[model samples]
Target: MQEGCIEWKLDEKENINSLEELARHGARVMLRIALNDEIKEFMEKGETLRDEEGRRLVYRNGYHREREIQTGIGPIKVKQPRVDSRKAEVKFNSKILPKYMRRTESIDAFIPILYLNGVSTGDFSEVMEGLLGKGKGVSANTVVRLKAEWEKEYAEWRKRDLSAKRYCYIWADGIYLKHRDEEDEKSCILVVIGVNENGDKEFLAIDSGIRESALSWKEVLLGLRERGMEEPKLAIGDGGMGFWSALREVYPQTREQRCWVHKTANVLNQLPKKLHPMAKKMLQEIYLSPDKAQAERGIGRFVNVFEDKYPKAVKSLTKDAEELLTFYDFPAAHFQHIRTTNPIESSFSTIRLRTKKMRNCGNRKTTLAMLYKLSQQVEKGWRKLRGFKEIPYVLEGMPYLDGSRMENAVV
Candidate 1:
């Protein structure tokens, strides 16, 4: 029985080894074929030989050197075709394998995504060594270089023009990251996302702040204004955050909506554990109602049911009552987006997952840069909000009556 088990283990090891070898061999063949095809196309197009004045310059020079490129499958050897052109200096550069490129750009881009997916910098070498072979591991230096590049990218993204664009709605939130140096220290990252006139969501600002304080939020909002970001029609955020206070001071014209998710959680926290499920259902009724009138009825029922026993919970619900139902005034199609700050939540889910595992994310600059890069990656998959076509009407100040355009509304 022991002999059979040993044989099974050996067979499994052999199979895994063979699969990796096969992948490397296949990649080599594909790369060689592609390079050969590029040469053939170049020669056929008369690109190898150019006529300068009356002198003909020939660029067809034999293969200069053989190089090995590290790929996910392992290192694949490639022969670089060189050109010795007289009169006109021309070089044969393969689009498949660029000059001095040891690794593919796709591999470079994937490294950061992997880092943001909860793979720590120290674990990168081990993780990559498993996927790629022994010496092909991603070094710490490479990660540092990538972080530097990402910092430059973040800087450029922050300075982009917002004067030409207008947002219909914005979601604001502050996320805290624990510092490694100090156990008691936590840094707050204030983030804002805007839905444009086209109903497309965009990441607007990500700045380091002081625990979502009114001053911190005001600095962020003022920065947006300085960058030429027009005042959005509505802003959604947690009821307890200082964002509302800052918004009132910066752009009072922008209406406010308290996130139903945050409000529900706050109310539930104040109530008894057993009352949570029923209390949550009652709160949902208020947000999910067809119109403001029905929503108000739902709110009244909740207040009446909890006021006597859970007066504090009832107070939590009624304190932001007007803000909670502000979405009803907007087009019905947009209510789902306006009712909550899910857009910000969804984008930061990756950052939260990664940072929680990290516990202490270096310094404030590094933390903000990491969060910005992670958010940028997440923004790629974000879908346009539903009922996007109505954005123009919203921007035009047309009144929406119970989620529909008001009758005989003037342009």
Candidate 2:
């Protein structure tokens, strides 16, 4: 054995512990090494010990320290350790322990934690510190700590989930926000949510666009089909010609359900503030009517009552009456779910609120990664939302679903 060097056998745990003890036996080595903020994080988190595969090895709490000195034989080899895991915690706090600390093995603890609080990065940091603090490896700048893993995961996620599968219904729309990428131009984010056979909604894809153009929406929808989505039974969206064109290009047979909420918003925008209540009442009669015939009658009543005073509003309402009530054709049971794209809208609100803190995205990939992380958060707590329970009953006369028919339907 060299006088000032340490070596160990791979099979000897006792020797390893003894070596650790020897390193920390005397004066504590408190050498500070410069590292990128991220590497420093690994030291801070007690995640410094990693396997050859780069996966973190838990329960090993030792960090490497290096020193150079002029010795009899030039620069002598020196490696020392200060504080390691063998030291018992001098103190403990029951109230300070983070709940997420227990799930150390999970690679995705951040998602569920952030989702619970309904906050973005800054808020996410505050909530974590508020609950857990520094002891559990919680940091104020968590996104910086998570950059490497997030990048890797985002890349893998983009390439992994590919399938040319069909959906029963897909809700598609865009959320606009001001992102100061190169300049503070209005940017639109495209989101698509697919409804599967069991009436479960799954997020399919999201993309950013300068303007909600036909070209951009078409690219997004085309990318979806290219990734895995096949023909859809229906595609619900705001009645943008671009959205319709994109849907048509992707799934020729899919039914189009113009978002009722957006159309109503357009109607209400034209009315004066005081007249909104009356306008809403008139619009409700059209939308709430049980059948197309009754809805038409309601529309007639609305026009007769408001046309002279609010010709523009009446004309807009009458123009969109058919598209607004398309949900009625798809069985009364499915009406509530299909009338608007509220599910996707709610999901967007979370993402927007989270990212809006930053003036601009770091880059396109980071923007996408943030959105993906937020979506994963939503999915973590998501329950299978109950759809039209009477769907089977509503379609009773339709040929009974045999095994082959059912298989074909899903495919």
Candidate 3:
């Protein structure tokens, strides 16, 4: 073995304690080598970069005095590499490990998520201390400060310009979150999500609204317009009267498509509890039909069976008949995507639980800000729309008939 080097065999067996020891040993070894590499690249300027003495300007001096730094796995002792520069104005600093950083950034990041996920503030100190070491836990006051920053971030995001924004399609919905008190339950958050020409989906708005009313929805739509959001090619949402009314006023050119999932749920609500299983199947057949004509026929079958005894259900199903089948006029690859507002619904399924946990935690503005921050986190995981290649065709006003692109046909 080399006098100043270490090696290991992967086939060696070890216990948990030994494994942790091995991890600590590995951290020290890697840090030493990485620091040395940083110095090697700093010595040159140009082809004739060296001094007349033909010597490189920046050279390694030695390791800084060792210090124990805190990490997720536990504290590890490290010695940063030192650089002696002939150029007095230039000095090297380790971005990987700053001079005063006693703890890893991961520890700081983990604390807030822990607190927000139902860990009470009082218990935060003990929980973090156990993981990062004694005296390292952040105070509850610190958490409060972090939360204030959260509010400011969400406020700034609300006013961002959208002058260059355009979406092929959008999904709008009003989500009612339950609170500890009944009065708080009356208010709902209105969400608008749009997919740009690149097919990347993004949140356009998340504002507290008065139960999806026309006036409330008008503000969101107007805000999007004020920020220069262009009219989407189509908008998919439930049979919300307020949203449709607002859409007409702001972007009448954008066609409407009713969410089949919500419409089916509404139709079943009007039927007998005993008939739900049967009626639901009938409703599915309508939207799941292979083509617009077949889907309309399926709707006919449903109305014929229920109209005599269930006039209300029949009306509910037939009222939005045209909008419900609008997906057929777009790319068949997007039929499942456009037939419903599942993009918004699926993205928010997790937020509903967080909202429930946060019941009575704060007032309307604060609550919304927290939701905005959390949603921004959730937004990171959203995937692009399926069949994104067809987005250009959608934006160009290419005609579609029963999910087939009719390129040569007239509008």
Candidate closest to the true structure, highest TM-score: 1
Q: What is the lDDT of residue 406 in candidate 2?
A: 36
Residue-level lDDT of model 3, residues 1-411, one tens digit each, is: 988886754324433357666786677667766766666565443224457799866777887888888788777888777777777776777777888787676665565445434466677778878875688666788667767887798888889998786689999999776533355654888999898998888888989899899999999999999988999999999998999999999999999999999998999899999999999998888888888889899989988899999999999999999999898999998888898998888866765667466634345665666667666766778888889999999999999998889978886
Candidate 3 stretches with Cα past 4 Å from truth are 1-138, 178-186, 354-359
**In terms of lDDT, which candidate is strongest?**
3
- The lDDT per prediction is 0.80, 0.59, 0.80
Report how far residue 154 has shifted in candidate 1, in Å.
1.5
Per residue, candidate 2 scores C-alpha lDDT tens digits across 34-117 of 122333444466666556787654442353444432211122223432233322542111221222222222324454334323
The residue-by-residue lDDT of candidate 1 on 1-411, one tens digit each, is 775331112323334348777667667666666777888776666554556565436456788588878786777777776655564445456777788898765566567556645577887888888877787788988888878888888888887889898899999988776654463367678999998987788899998888899999999999899989988899999974588889999998999999998888999999989988998988888888888999999989998898998899999989899988888778999988888889888777765777677645666665566777777667778888899999988888888877988958775
In terms of lDDT, the poorest run of 10 residues in model 2 is 396-405
Let me know the TM-score candidate 1 reaches against the reference structure. Answer: 0.78
Name the 10 consecutive residues with the lowest summed lDDT in model 1: 5-14
Off by over 4 Å in 2: 1-128, 134-137, 140-142, 159-165, 183-185, 350-362, 388-411
Residue pairs clashing in model 1 are: 332-403
Residue 117 accuracy (lDDT) in model 1: 53
* TM per candidate: 0.78, 0.62, 0.77
- Residue-pair clash count for candidate 2: 3
